[model samples]
Target: MNMKWYEVAKIRMKELDINQEKLAEHLDMTKGAISHWLNARREPSLDDIAKIMKYLGFSEFVVNHDGTISTAGGNENVSNLIPYKPGKEYPVLSSVQAGCWAEAIEAYTLDEISEWLESDAHIQGDAFWLKVEGDSMTAPTGQSVPEGNYVLFDTAKEAMNGSLVIAKLTDSNEATFKKLIIDAGQKYLKGLNPAWPMVPVNGNCKIIGVAVEAKMRFL
Candidate 1:
């Protein structure tokens, strides 16, 4: 019989010589929440599962074409496991170019791009990297993406409530990055910083893509 996800997690935790408290600390979650997840009282979201797997020292997990997950670095038979492949490389675009991304992509070939970055994130459709310019998205506490970091955006991903997105406003020539918030039937673009005012998503505002990942540069 196949082991359940929680069972696998428990076994891994035992091998690593850590209890739920330690695991929760590493994940930045409360111990009660971790307990609920491990006890199977609640289900973890896809994002939470990814974080747990990553913190447990699993390098990668493969989703088979048939929709089955294959855990890497396991004792399972290897013949049927899919081959591991390196992450895809995506082009880095300027804020102005990203504002008119559809047109820019059509105009320039991949070879014409001067810089490219690799990401292991599972993304769909066209994707690109954009360097953050200001402190609008930087927060004083909790989740934050500071200025000067590179954010990866996927055009095919659906932008949901609380998603980070790249957007183009009718009044601006450059694209803006912010957290997307949906309340009732209305949408708003919120800056993570408390001092920054939120912007309403009007007819003149266009969502470009959802941000999938962010990377910080040392130099």
Candidate 2:
């Protein structure tokens, strides 16, 4: 998917070795205004985005009617090189039709990815983002994962008892986010909500990844 204008601006800044302070200076705008736009506290008009793009030295920026933005034609010229920070970026999988992403970590294509999530865990493994579809993981009292949140997971981390994980039953192609439980050497998939029943891990169960972070946004 095409990124929003601010995301493209962030990539441009990184390419040009310019910090937000320098970007504000180049745009002749207050740092606070720039910060607001970056943090999604406010949005810039199309004209403002154009000006920011020009100052970032992009050859051209195409804004679609749907508000997505992309750049073309200009090379990213970095005069000051910063140390490369190796962070794990996970692709957001949108559907089970895309196949089992957890089964083949390196085979995911750009088109299958809905968005990207950068993980701070920095573990020596891959990661992915799963969008919570229902309130099955919402607990009545503590640590509820409400519906419509995003969960970031580490593929290398083992899912222990009581650990929340992304899992799929052997017979099913779809992946699910839920708490994992092991009892008497039998594994089960569990929901935090009291109304949901604990499901046995029938056939073959695949543990994709362990939950590392959960994000919820309101507007």
lDDT of each: 0.71, 0.68
The model with the greatest TM-score is 1
Off by over 4 Å in 1: 1-85, 95-107
The TM-score, computed over Cα atoms with residue i paired to residue i, of candidate 1 is 0.59
TM-scores, in order shown? 0.59, 0.52
TM-score for model 2? 0.52
Regions of candidate 2 where Cα sits further than 4 Å from its true position = 1-88, 95-107
Q: Tens-digit lDDT track for model 1 on 117-160?
A: 88766577789988877788788999888887899999998999
Total colliding residue pairs, candidate 1: 0
After TM-score superposition, the amount by which residue 31's alpha carbon in candidate 1 deviates from its true location, in angstroms, is: 15
Write candidate 2's Cα lDDT for 12-125 as tens digits.
676645677657755779999999987768978888878877666554557666656654432233221122444457787652211122332332587766578664343436
